[model samples]
Target: MSSDPWETLRAATRARVGLGRAGDGLTTAENLRLAAAHAQARDAVHAPLDVDAVVGALGERAGPVVVSQVADRTEYLQRPDLGRRLASDHGLEAGTWDLALVVADGLSATAVHEHAAAMVDVLLPRLEGWAVAPVVVARQARVALGDEIAEALGARMVLVLIGERPGMSAPDSLGAYLTFDARPGRVDSERNCVSNIRPPDGLTYDAAAEVLVSLMTEAFRLQLTGVRLKDTGAALPSAAG
Candidate 1:
């Protein structure tokens, strides 16, 4: 890995950090950016605000907000349903959004910032008349939060772009999950997930984005998703203008 940091330096260059070669196989720019990102992460960790704070803030309020909260890391973890909907609000019934997209702080906020926006940027224009709800930053949220978000938006399809669990290989990795008519009672297997969302990680942002949009578009046309939607574009209607 050390012998081949040329591509790494290019990516860093696009990210707009100064370039310098550090003795250890990594560019000085690479080390500096990583160090800065780590420092920011540390500060965020030490801050009083976190996924818990985000969830609590949502819980304490009442309105048309889609209730998104962490389920596995705090007091709410025990109550799977609370991690679901806000009992007091239940949110306005989603009437069917053009396209619903949820941005969650699943494993790393940095991941979402780095890749989710780019994926979503290209995806929205591909889908016909898709109007994305404001990108909701979820805290302590889970993979299933996409359903609730879809329900809140009353959307035909829900796609959640979140940070993947950090590994030594890729800390800021991103992932995506797409479901047709996602709701509270839906099963996990009902949705299609696209993971490892970074350049040369698993799928390129643009290509993976095409697949994601294609899945939802297919679902809308065929009225199905999951395995039923895979490689089934032939059965779906042509895209609307």
Candidate 2:
């Protein structure tokens, strides 16, 4: 029998559970790992998003990309309201799409840089025939920012792929939010979120895409999201399977 019960469980998930103690506190190794994760979380929050790289990775498949109203990382963190508006008229063609896809650097630029393009690759194809607006690449953005972007594009729905707040175990997790009838003043309950989207440790791109597609389909038909929309969709098969 293993002395640490968590050792066996740890292999099953990335969650930090059943960590054994050293003396009266965490083991030195555990403490060090925690500190490193904390540092990563902080770095992710302050990291600068490279909009051009994001655009390039996206392969210009959908449409033009644009920034949000948030001027800089500092101001973005300080003024949440600013991130929710459009920086300018550069927002793409309005009133032409059923969905507005937003890729944003929400707390973790690393998460966006790592997963945004891949997730889009999986998601966009699944949403074929649905009018998709330009893929908006926003910097220092919040979840609500997608609402205004969708509103600007006159999209019926806004699918925002942003970085989830960093945690000790998952510092670079990406999250997706889908809202029906997206616009400013919409509350949190009006949106549905698919979170923990980093591969190997969290939901893979394919799985997240599957979940997202299912939700979007339902949201459009029922015209609602958030608590009202249940995520009973099946996850995609593992790459190994």
Candidate 3:
């Protein structure tokens, strides 16, 4: 058995903990690991999303691919507001839809590239009876962009599947944001978010799908999202029961 009491805790999570020290600094191995994690987080932020690959992965489930008004990655980083609007009102046509699905390359393109399609695969099946719009792939996007897209598409609700901001331990974490009666000016309080959705070390695909579906069902019935809504995890069966 390890002498360190924190060893068991450290093994149970990806979090950096119980890292033994060398005099006044982190041990050489710990330092190297930290450097690698930092590099991955930076790369996740800077890397461009592969739109074609995402569309190919989603296949017929995907609709038109779109770009935010930010123009380039550098501008996207500097001007967050631009990312919330579409470049132009093209490809999308107005039609009444029960729900709109948007896949976006937010802060971490790697997250979307790796897990967005799989998430869609798991989520869409759960929304069987709903009139779900084809998935819209967005580049240089922010969470608010889904509002404009869904509004243009005339959807009653919008779900934006995006890459969450990369952290030291979770560079590929995905997130989902849901909004009811979506419009351009909707504030953060008007949305419900399901985050940290990268499996194995994060929320598994099935678990995240359950939460999102439950939120959507309630949002449609309640006609709202955000703070007023709650994910009681009621849709999922209880382990204790």
Provide the clashing-pair count of each candidate structure: 6, 0, 0
How many backbone clashes are present in model 1? Answer: 6
Each candidate's TM vs. the true structure? 0.62, 0.90, 0.96
What ordering of candidates by lDDT runs from best to worst? 3, 2, 1
lDDT string for model 1 (1-241, tens) is 6665466776643353334556756786677777876666543322222444433333422123344443344444455455455333445455546666676666566576567656766666676567655555555556677777677667777777777766544666788887787888887678787787887655677777667776776778988777766754342335557
Global Cα lDDT for candidate 3:
0.93
Ten contiguous residues minimizing lDDT sum, candidate 1: 56-65
How well does candidate 2 score on lDDT at residue 139?
72
- The 10-residue segment of model 2 with minimum total lDDT is 232-241
lDDT of 3 by residue, 17-53 (tens): 8899999999999999999999999999999999989
Q: What is the C-alpha RMSD of each candidate to the true structure, in Å?
A: 8.6, 2.6, 1.6
Instruction: State each model's CA lDDT, in order.
Output: 0.62, 0.85, 0.93
TM value for model 2 = 0.90
User: Superposing every Cα of model 2 onto the true structure, what RMSD results?
Assistant: 2.6
User: How good is model 3 by TM-score?
Assistant: 0.96
